[model samples]
Target: MTKPLIEITNINKSYQNGDQELRVLKDISLTIDEGEFVAIMGPSGSGKSTLMNIIGLLDKPTSGNYDLEGQEVDSLGDQELAKVRNQQIGFVFQQFFLLAKLNALQNVELPLIYAGVSPSKRRELSKQYLEKVELVERMHHLPSELSGGQKQRVAIARALVNSPAIILADEPTGALDTKTGAQIMDLLTDLNREGKTIIMVTHEPEIAAYATRQIVLRDGVITEDTRKGGEI
Candidate 1:
């Protein structure tokens, strides 16, 4: 059998708040196979974001075992973790984090820049992804010049430029109108159909419906897990 793309076991996350220990995630275990589009749903403070951060290597679990592409990662050093993140994970968030000073194409090229890619190659690849997202016409426009949907598209292009193994999106549509949000979801669906593994955190049922599998979290625990047809 092929190894799962992500394997997380007995994961826990905690933070010290004044004199008390606040536990956010509790012994959560999950496995995501390659090409699976999974949506994580939860209410406020349910630990969904914490889990996503751990999966994306933006943060570490206090105690757990996490394996990515069959290799253990929980014990990797900061630099190693950064390398893995740059090579294996792409992130999208509700707030488009594009630099206002940079144009769409330049924002997309940022990751490649950190990866030590040549300027010419970075521009070429960034252009390719921007075109793929149908934003070629606006590639030269800055984030301030684009609409909410357009800005998110530019962020998506930036995320895809790295060719990461997984895309982790948190509240991707929170700031857009229904129509624009639908368009973004369609783009994500198309990417997933093209075999990219996506793990999105959303509170909207309609948005979650775009994914093939849904996992609901409440109070730091999974309460429901369903695939298509409501299969658990």
Candidate 2:
């Protein structure tokens, strides 16, 4: 059998708030196979964002195990975690987190720089991903010079430039208008069809509809896990 791309088992997370312990996630178990597009949906405080952070290696679970590409990662040190995050995960956020000083191509090349890719190779790969996202013409434009949709496309291109094992998007369309959001979703769907594993967190049902599978959370627990057009 082909190994799953992501395996998360019995995970939990909590934070201390004054004298209280606030649990953000509880006993979560999930598996994502390669080439699958998964969506996570929930209301505010549902722990959806927390789960996304753990899955993206930005945070560690309070308990249990997580494996990425068959390698255990829950116990890695901070530096190692950073390395893995750089090499294995690409992140897309609602806000286009592009550096204002950098142009689109330069933003895309940032990850490659950390990965120690040569200058020529970085430019080549960044340009290819920009082309893939249909942003080749805006390659030299700064974030402020692009439209909202164009900025998001530039962000997506930056995410793809690393060729990471998975793309973790959090509320990727929250900042766009309906039409622009739909265009971004269509772009994501195309990327998933091309075999990139994706896990997106969104509160919008229309946005979630683009995913092959949907997982809904409530009060730090999974309330539903279902495929598109199917019951849990």
Candidate 3:
């Protein structure tokens, strides 16, 4: 049988605050298969962001196991984790994190540059992803010159440029108006239909509705996990 793309088991995360331990996540377990579109939903301080960070490899759990493509990741060193993250996970953020100085194309090329792809190949791949995101015409525009939606599109292009196994989006629509947010959700839905595994963090029910599965976190524990058709 094929393994799940991501398998997280008994995950626990905590932080130290002035000699007190603050638990952010408690004994969470989940599996995400390739091509699944999952939304992690919660109110403020529900540990949803912490869970996203662990899944994205930006943070480790205080305890428990995370396996990406069947390989144990909890024990990986920072460098090794970085390498794995670059190769297997692409990130999109609420702020659209594009460099203000770089044009859309250049921003998309950043990942390939870090991966050490040839310059010509990087340009080629970046343009291809920009086209996929329908932002090729704005390739030369800087973040300042683009609209909020356009900036997010560029961020999406950058996320796709690496061809990572999973795309992790944290509050992707938070920075846009309703219409623009819907457009972005449509784009993301299209990408998911094309077989991309998308894991998104959002507090809005409307935004979370775009995903096939919704996992609700409350007070550091998963309160609900539901698929669109029914519970899973």
Cα lDDT of model 2 by residue, 1-232, tens digit? 6569999999999899999999999999999899889999999999999999999887888898999888899668888889988888999999989999999999999999999999999999999999999999999999999999999999998888888889999999999999999999999999998889999999999999999999999999999999977965
Better TM-score candidate (2, 3): 3
For candidate 1, the 10 contiguous residues with the lowest summed lDDT are: 1-10
> Poorest 10 consecutive residues of model 2 by lDDT?
69-78
For candidate 2, report its TM-score.
0.97
What tens-digit string does per-residue lDDT give for candidate 1 at 202-223?
Answer: 9999999999999999989888
TM-scores vs. true structure, each candidate: 0.98, 0.97, 0.98
If ranked by TM-score, best first, what sequence of candidates would result?
3, 1, 2
Inter-residue clash pairs, candidate 3? none
User: If the candidates were sorted by their lDDT against the true structure, best first, what order would they fall in?
Assistant: 3, 1, 2
Tens digit per residue, CA lDDT, model 3, 5-29? 9999999999999999999999999
* TM-score, structure 3 vs. true: 0.98
Best by lDDT: 3
Q: Cα lDDT of model 2 overall? A: 0.93
Off by over 4 Å in 2: none
Candidate 1: clashing pairs of residues: none
